[model samples]
Target: MKRFVILIFIISLLFTGCWDKREINQLAFVQGLGIERGKDDMIHLIVQILKPGLLAAGGGGAGGTGGGSAVGKPYAVFQASGVDFAKAFANLNDELPRSLFMQYNEIIFLEEKFARSGIYKTLDFMTRNPEFRRTAYILVVTGGSLQELFDLPNTKQLERYPYKEVLGMIENQKNTSSSYVCDLNEFLEMLEIPKEAPITGRLEIVKKDGKAIGVRMAGSAVFNNDKLVGFLEEQDTKAIMTLKNKLRRSTLTLDKGLKGEKVHISFVVIKAHTDIIPKVKGKDIFFDIKINIETHMNEQESKYDLTEPKNLEKLQLLINDKIKQGIEHALFVLQKKYNADVVGFINILHQKNPKLWKEVEKDWDKIYPEVKFNVTVKSIVRRTGLSSKPIQPR
Candidate 1:
């Protein structure tokens, strides 16, 4: 029994040893930033790999200390191309001894041309890769190369790129409802459904002094079957946010009967709700969307009496009109200009009235351009900031 126990202890020690061992110092830490493109019918991969040592040193300073981003030869931005994504990555491995690791990858940028060609193939690689995170943010770059995106200046002190900085800003903004950070799984799920259109973050390089300077989230890219269909500008994106009940705290400027003077009102979204009702009459599908929004004034530019019911009524009407117009324009652009149903209105109709959807499912896109949509926006301005009256005296 003593001999058996000794043998068993030896076996346990052997099993405890790591069979697949890797040193953190030898591995490259990827900080969620990459760009994907196509050239000569092959996949092009550009990775913005993070430098851990520099990141550590920079973060070690005072919490808010700043000194023009850590100056270490820390990050290595590289590019490679091949017939398949894996092969391209494998080719990259030939250059560096350490394997290409993407566990911390945060954002995926797809060029417009490549997106129009079809993203399913590239997305397949990302989704199937065991090491890739399912929640990495996805963006569509307009009229720029993967190299251009990588060349943007690093203004943050933590050795971060513009892509990460912009996304951080959007996440930290007061209005967080409509502005969501989409990942591989979320985008793929939305694309798989036939009735829904997928939206992705849009990026563009802003140049200054003959150099790539900054990055901006221009708007949202509306997709149809993984193809580039169209984009919703800033205003349209905001409108979609309102309809989707995603607005956090946004300002609405209104013309208050004064020529060349407008009232800038900041409001925090208190409550938001949306309802869709479908009606069919002789092959015509009519959708009525009712949106109820409640807000508190964060600021009022002009002097106005808040206690007056009449003024409040006018303010409510103006808010409703602005929201309605924004929605109407977005829908029109989606239907006529892009021929894409990005708002998932068709899906809503199908869910609410499946029978009608079944009948029109086959020809929904063809009929979408002609479908009549009625939108009703109801807004209630519940509070007028800390002071009941505007600071500017009447």
Candidate 2:
């Protein structure tokens, strides 16, 4: 009996209530962050915090209708400055009533000036901090005020939260295939590799009538390690995504020469893949990119019987040529213009020919600009859509 009582007493002692637990109301949850360079050699930090009460109140009562008008903005914005990223983040507490929490942070925006100056400080802070989630997306703000981006009014009525709207813009990349996005984890991983450079999706303020109304996400910011080197235009960005096998779906519109006239045709890409092969001849090196694409005819402007075997072959050839041109242009910009290997050429070389990679690794920067590239594209039009030919005038 005595042993049973002692054991029961010991078990009871283990039932202590929630220690080191913080109440939700006492912590401010950050939705997004913007980093920029400030005056006086300080770093500026902007944060968007979610207001739970306001959001809950904004949600309609029983049916999805009324309370949205009564509630003010569902989030608040705050800014601060410090000598370093860590100190700048810490300084937010001075203006905040609750402890700032970052577990829910979804996106991070780096101002162009800050990124150009070098993002090593910001990258260092993010990598060392356990509070920041690795999956949160990172972007570079180009040619705009970071504060204005944060202050964008949710006028579109498409999304209630400003951060959600911006996040949705990044998500749109999968459909448009004109931009590229990467999370903090991916960016950090690329930074760790000497041969690989890091790139982030580009963000800019959308204005109409000279007033900032929303934000736009397009193109990409190319970086040589932690410093922003240049920006890739939308077309180049799309080509890079295709070459890297990151494109899910996209539409290509090209003017085709048919019957001594030009006809516009649109192809909806269904599936696409690229094979990069590295060739070595003695000491000379070359890369061959073989791109295979599967697409469907979406639109045809003129009454060209494309269903015919000969016409279909010509259409496929045109598509192949168009894709080849895009890939070539992208390569020209990356190699000849920027001299930055944002593509996975290093990875291909390391995997396919590690021995050769070792010999040329040191001179990759100098040789990359002069490296020759051969591109071959093949496209198949699997479906002609509902009608094989354009409808004739009745």
Each prediction's TM-score versus the true structure = 0.86, 0.92
User: What does candidate 2's lDDT look like per residue over 36-59, in tens digits?
Assistant: 999987999999887667545656
Q: For model 2, what is the alpha-carbon lDDT of residue 228? A: 90
Q: Per model, how many backbone clashes are there? A: 5, 0
Task: Give the C-alpha miss distance for residue 385 in model 1, angstroms.
Answer: 0.8
List model 1 lDDT by residue over 35-98, tens digit each.
Answer: 4656678877777665555656664221123433557434668777888777887777677756
lDDT of each: 0.72, 0.84
In candidate 2, where is summed lDDT lowest over 10 consecutive residues?
60-69
Residue 363 error for model 2, in Å?
1.5
> For model 2, what is the error of residue 239's alpha carbon versus the real structure, in angstroms, after optimal superposition?
0.9
Q: TM-score for model 2?
A: 0.92
Q: Could you tell me how far off, in angstroms, the CA of residue 292 lies in candidate 2 after the best superposition? A: 0.3
**lDDT score for residue 104 of model 1:** 64
Cα lDDT, model 2, residue 211: 71
